[model samples]
Target chain A: MEALVRPKLQEAYEAVKRALECVHFCILIANCEVKYWGRASSKLGRGQRVIMLKQDGSVLVHRPYGYEPVNWQPPGSRLSAELKDGKLVVRAVRLRPWEELVVEVYEVHLLAHCKLRDDARFEMYGSEGDIRDLLANNPELIEKGLKRVEVERKVEGGSIDILFIDERGRLVVVEVKRGTAGAEAVIQLKKYVERLKGELGRDVRGILVAEDLARGVRGLLVREGLEFKKIDLRKLFEVSKEQGASLTHWLTRC
Target chain B: MEALVRPKLQEAYEAVKRALECVHFCILIANCEVKYWGRASSKLGRGQRVIMLKQDGSVLVHRPYGYEPVNWQPPGSRLSAELKDGKLVVRAVRLRPWEELVVEVYEVHLLAHCKLRDDARFEMYGSEGDIRDLLANNPELIEKGLKRVEVERKVEGGSIDILFIDERGRLVVVEVKRGTAGAEAVIQLKKYVERLKGELGRDVRGILVAEDLARGVRGLLVREGLEFKKIDLRKLFEVSKEQGASLTHWLTRC
Candidate 1:
């Protein structure tokens, strides 16, 4: 099995599926591509958006990462980043909904170190904020509550990882995992959101973040009006070193 | 939900399916009681054996062992030992064939300042071997073999903590990990077994001596045929304190 494609399929699944509906998509799993239609979901052919993101130094995974080259191959998904106006612009997705009804959501902390060099392109979380600032200045991002926030909301007995919030003080709960964004993660997030609404009134909302979540996750997200986000360490480092922007300035701008 | 169950399942699975399959029978899993079915394979429950041995402090596991209470829950498994005659007559289940297939095997060596203490009833791992004895006893366990033995056996691994020769003349592997044992211990032992097989062929046998092992690992062992006999660490300490038993008597007892 190709070790590369599994994560990508997981990302797509996270993007497309609803929490309860995800079990249908994940009946049989091999890497990112799941066993649907009685066949293994192989890698997406060229120009595909689902590409597995492999981790190196400074990443964490609670479970072993799964990849298969024999049956499935990750679709070649590339993000295009171009500074539009003053804010970073991206056509990619963020954490999504309906998926939270199944699995656990981790509180992700952005841990980074800076290494500056000459001219290069850059990004923050693949988009939105500038990578340069993330590397050079993090407090600016953290204090603005743009990158991290503390969430106090319950689901059944478990709590949610708040990803983003709005003026109404509503939460965007997110679940981050390093391996395949599974059906469980989708379902878990959904339940979390539902419970959050009951606990914190109807103003609560949520998202799911991962190295790559599955298609089922996405299906759920789209229907539930949630978001899906993937961050690549390789691309993240590349952007931080090359992009021309002050870390604090870029974070503050976002 | 109970932490003890997962590791025990993993252990019971391996010990039955592989290690002592020719001798013991294995049965019972999770919370399910064994009911006679014509199709069932093993007839005994090694889970009790494992739980019993762990209590004796001859084999170590988690501290505060046993299942958690759920409302007005029933009491979990407990081990109480009674020694009769010269041989330790433990009231425990013999490892069943199917059960042998499940408990994952490990080889380890404890390295510290004392001998095993069965009396440390609640200590996750028992007392250690004496520091002086450990220093003095080192040379004999790891006595260098002839050049041909070294050349033919390829003993160029593991920066020698302690060594012993099993019946097959294979270098026995040992390790002492600080804190507790979990999946990492099982994985490390498996790696060592593979290394010995790959590097020394039929010349190396693995032995694990540690303070404790995780309860969940047995589930992983049942099918892999991972074998390493359990060390009665308490006996080791007893032997150290007594200093009267001959090597033949000592080795046979363990």
Candidate 2:
């Protein structure tokens, strides 16, 4: 039985291995044979194997270490209030009441916005071909929309450097500059959000993508009912290059 | 000099604060004193002042802690082409590749060879007002020669959802799933990339929009060449609401 399933899983594992720039760890096919399967990445090494799987209504399982949820996310504060940073803070962004503006001077800037890998290092691929090959092997992941658009898109009073919506429908309106988010972007995205909601409608969320987001600005957005996502363009481009490699593979193979 | 510039910056900041949820983050004003910015959620106690200004741009400004980078990034492998878990392991997904793929998948999807982003969360907002509103805020995105053709987008097998292309100078094909980015999306986007590249140019980019993203699938896309992003439908509605609040503020003053 071990021999039969091991071959198929091994084939899948190899397919994954052949297409990546980095490999953290790999779990054993046996471990994944049971239901609810997963393993610690640190333990993956030569000759070691572990995974979780299930068969026929069974909750069979295997985990080198027990699996339990660690970082708990409270339901994001009621979606009605303004988010200061990534957290829920202000009761709301006051759709009907403009408050008196009396505050000190500060600068916030929005930089590049792109989907980052869960494995930070996974985005460090050095070549585009490598990234493209990885995509060709995946049984899932419909791979048609894989291009990155970077343009100086200008509007009535401003210009957005990179305006994109990611694979998961998140509208990431990135405003990049020489400085960090604290310098000019945070405010810029904030303003963009205000104008967008006004012209777009009252149900759109925006991300203030930047290099280093100031804590205060993060708080302001979370409390103000906005979502904040961060990324460094250098790292993102590196990751994109790998994706390019994967695309190249598909272009050649198919 | 400080006082004079402070008010303008403050007004800009206030304008920004009110504009963020509306998607106004841009670069036109980045050269101003404020260069970049984002939103921070703050738990304020009315009179409890938060340190919102940066002294030297290097200091970690507080108020809203900068939006935290997503937690849980998988680690990296140390060996070269090592075998583990009954399978052969080689490089990491985020590093430079030894050999890469070169296929452009965007063209294929647009040509009906790949899938799109219409899953569970893609349809969550279900209102034209919401979808149109979301796209409207991104005014800077070019849509001249691009086509806004509606088609039956293939999400997960058997789940064909509504899809559209906001054709400007560059075609921005959007796949709206009901929920998030899963392993299946890798295949969906790959097809799109190939089709778009084939039909348009290698430069065509695809956007797979959903509400959530599974970690493995996201890593797979990074390893591949396709792009996918996550969006919270509830939060988007909130952004629109915040804009309403800003108008209310102006109205109250009048």
- Say which candidate scores most in TM-score: 2
User: Which stretches in model 2 have alpha-carbon errors above 4 Å?
Assistant: A1-151, A164-172, A177-179, A232-234, A246-254, B1-254
For model 1, the stretches where C-alpha displacement exceeds 4 angstroms are A1-155, A235-254, B1-254
Estimate candidate 2's RMSD in Å: 25.6
Q: On residues B43-113, what C-alpha lDDT tens digit does candidate 2 reach at each position?
A: 11111001111111111111111111111111221112222343222121223332211111110000000
lDDT of 1 by residue, A141-167 (tens): 211223335543445757665445533
RMSD of each: 30.9, 25.6
The TM-score obtained by model 2 is 0.23
Which lDDT tens digits does candidate 1 get at residues B1-254? 00112243334334333322232111111221111111112122211111112211111111011110000100111212222232122222222111111121221111101111111111112323332233224222222220111212233444323445533345665433433445665566566667766765765543344444567665664334444223333233333322332222211122
| TM-score of every candidate relative to the true structure | 0.21, 0.23
True contacts kept of each: 0.00, 0.00
Instruction: Report DockQ per prediction, comma-separated.
Output: 0.01, 0.02
